[model samples]
Target: MDYDDAYANVPHIPDGESYPPRWAAEAAAFREARATDRNDLGVSYGDTPRQAYDLFRPETAPKGTLVFVHGGYWLRFDRSYWSHLATGALARGWSVAMPSYDLCPDVRIAGITTQVARAIQNIAESEPGPLTLAGHSAGGHLVSRMIQPGLLPIDVTDRITTITPISPVSDLRPLLHTAMNAQFQLTEDTATAESPALMTERLDIPTHIWVGADERPVFLDQARWQADAWSCPLRIDKGRHHFDIIDALKDPVSPLMRDILG
Candidate 1:
């Protein structure tokens, strides 16, 4: 029942420290491999340095666009670490845009939410197209929130074909017990406002919830909560843990990839 221990992931994963370097290396290689197709290395969405995104476009007209957000509990990682995640979407004929945001401690979770909204709007304005938004971990909660009744303008929501938040944290109340709250600084009011699981209003747009079977039970429950509350479909990938669950996003033929591209 210790929320801190229960939610902690890196401690349980022996090689957790290696993940950052691996992500950075893979993202660099992906950029190099797709040098020609890659543009907008650091497109500014806001005035800050981190408020930027990278756009990877296919040579021919893209079927649509996929805006990807990376999750590090709103405190770690950036768009650079997740560039390779665009691979599957790109190969499947979708332009992919990955965005970086100002982290927690520097800003509250509530502020980060707006930053994402701004980032998505900036991308939407720059390259308007049918949009499919996806995020992981904290990113999942973000993409999910973007579709809430008043979060994004109706025009933008109308253009979003689907939203896929992998291993999303639908509810944020539990995090108050975890050490992460130091950076997140959540209160009952803010948690209620941000918890998609607890929200009664449902988005009209289609949504697909995904979580790896091996992830902590909290994640599975969160994913189910969003699916049930929103009347959407959920997919569980057996044997995939929290970190590796995202691997499918880079595989064009993976069921997860097809789900996003569709």
Candidate 2:
């Protein structure tokens, strides 16, 4: 389906619920599991302690590392609830890392992105090996920011073999016109400067862009746009929405997850 068709399928945001119920439940379960296994590390971003990340690894074996950045439209969510995302990768011998950063409005999107970059650098320093990076929603945007050529310090960027940004906000211009402005407070210039779509940048590592069949039209459009610009793989998960699509990652064998990890 085209981006428009994919977008028209998105469910309307209800008055009280921001994210879907299943996603909230899954995030809650992931956080609960992390309470026992969480390992916190402090990473510095300009002498402040606000930047840090949590590492979750399988007890017996590991094949590679997958670093996930949680998304809340650049405003909400954190690394804690995201440890559950490691489940599928752990079963497949991949360790998982999730980083927390200050939200936007309080901190500009640019600052938040930079902090995430520092988080990746710190994680890679401690665990050196083949790595795959993935992010969802705004986190997906952060992943793109993390891998932007010449942006990352050498050591971390060199280790990434593949990147998968699921339902990323590659373009921020449209968001400025939407209700998301409540938190993003995106100026046209800031949106344009921050968007990967307008940046004309590419990563040497293989990149895959995936969007749910039922994601917001803007999101699907941006995902496809990124794929077209970068000549990367573009995938649409059938019968899925923005939130449900990432749930498939909980199962390593999932077609979406396989494309991501491969």
Model 1: per-residue Cα lDDT over 155-185, one tens digit each: 7778899899999999999998898899889
The reply for model 2, stretches above 4 Å from the true place, is: 1-50
Q: In order, what lDDT does every prediction score?
A: 0.88, 0.75
> Candidate 1 — worst ten consecutive residues by lDDT sum?
31-40
Cα-lDDT of candidate 2:
0.75
Clashing pairs in 1: none
The C-alpha stretches of model 1 lying farther than 4 A from their native spots are none
Give the per-residue Cα lDDT of candidate 2 at 27: 62
